[model samples]
Target: MNKIKPGDIVVITHNTLPRLGVVLKVHKREDPTKDIARVHLAKHNKAYNFLISDMEKIIDKNT
Candidate 1:
């Protein structure tokens, strides 16, 4: 991925459920194996991380 940042609209599809989310923050993770992706969702108060493989491009509002 290029320089993805906070507020960028991204879709994170849940493996088990039909759900997509908007991206809130994109940052490097402490662990080398993981890149951090924060999402803004009303269903959950907390932000969730999805691996690069799990992320989909729906829109780029904040790009």
Candidate 2:
């Protein structure tokens, strides 16, 4: 998959209960680095951070 950058919109597709969020940062998906993606999501009504791989970029195909 192409590498995603900050500001990209991502959606969490895992967990028994799924949610959506945005990417605040990007990191290599391996050792040597610790920080993953920082997502701002709205679960029920509150927003929070989420991982990169844990979510998918929401591509606006309507453009």
Candidate 3:
């Protein structure tokens, strides 16, 4: 998997549904699995912290 960074787009499974969001910040820890990311959900207009491992980075096809 690619390393998730701020401004990257990602998808997270919420309540069994996939939600897309932009990464606002990433809090890295000594243990990579413990890393967390603050993502802004445009559809919901809210930001939430989610475990990095729980989210998948969305690659831009145009890039």
Candidate 4:
């Protein structure tokens, strides 16, 4: 998985139905591998916190 950063698009993979969101912020933990990300779901118009491990970054080839 690629490193998740603010503005990067990501998918919440922990749910039964994956939801797409844009990363807003990343909170680093003592263990770098356990970072948490703040993602904003446009559809829901709300922000949620999720473990980086539970999300998959989406790479845009058009970029």
**TM-score for each model:** 0.60, 0.59, 0.86, 0.86
lDDT of 1: 0.65
lDDT of 2 at 25: 59
Of candidate 2, the 10-residue stretch with the lowest lDDT total is 26-35
CA RMSD per model (angstroms): 2.9, 3.8, 2.1, 2.0
Q: For this target, which candidate reaches the highest TM-score against the unseen true structure? A: 4
**Every candidate's lDDT:** 0.65, 0.61, 0.88, 0.87
- Number of the candidate with higher lDDT, 3 or 4: 3
Write the residue-wise lDDT of candidate 3 on 1-63 in tens digits: 788888888999745988899999999999988999999998999999999988988864336
List runs of model 2 lying over 4 Å from the truth: 29-35, 44-49, 60-63
Extract clashing residue pairs from model 2: none
**How many steric overlaps are in each model, in order?**
0, 0, 0, 0
Model 1 C-alpha lDDT per residue in residues 1-63, reported as the tens digit of each score: 554566566566657663466777676778744776777665686677776556766666653
Q: Which parts of model 4 are misplaced by more than 4 Å?
A: 60-62
**Which residue pairs clash within candidate 3?**
none
lDDT of 4: 0.87
In candidate 3, residue 50 scores what lDDT?
93
- Superior candidate under lDDT, 1 versus 2: 1
Most lDDT-accurate candidate: 3
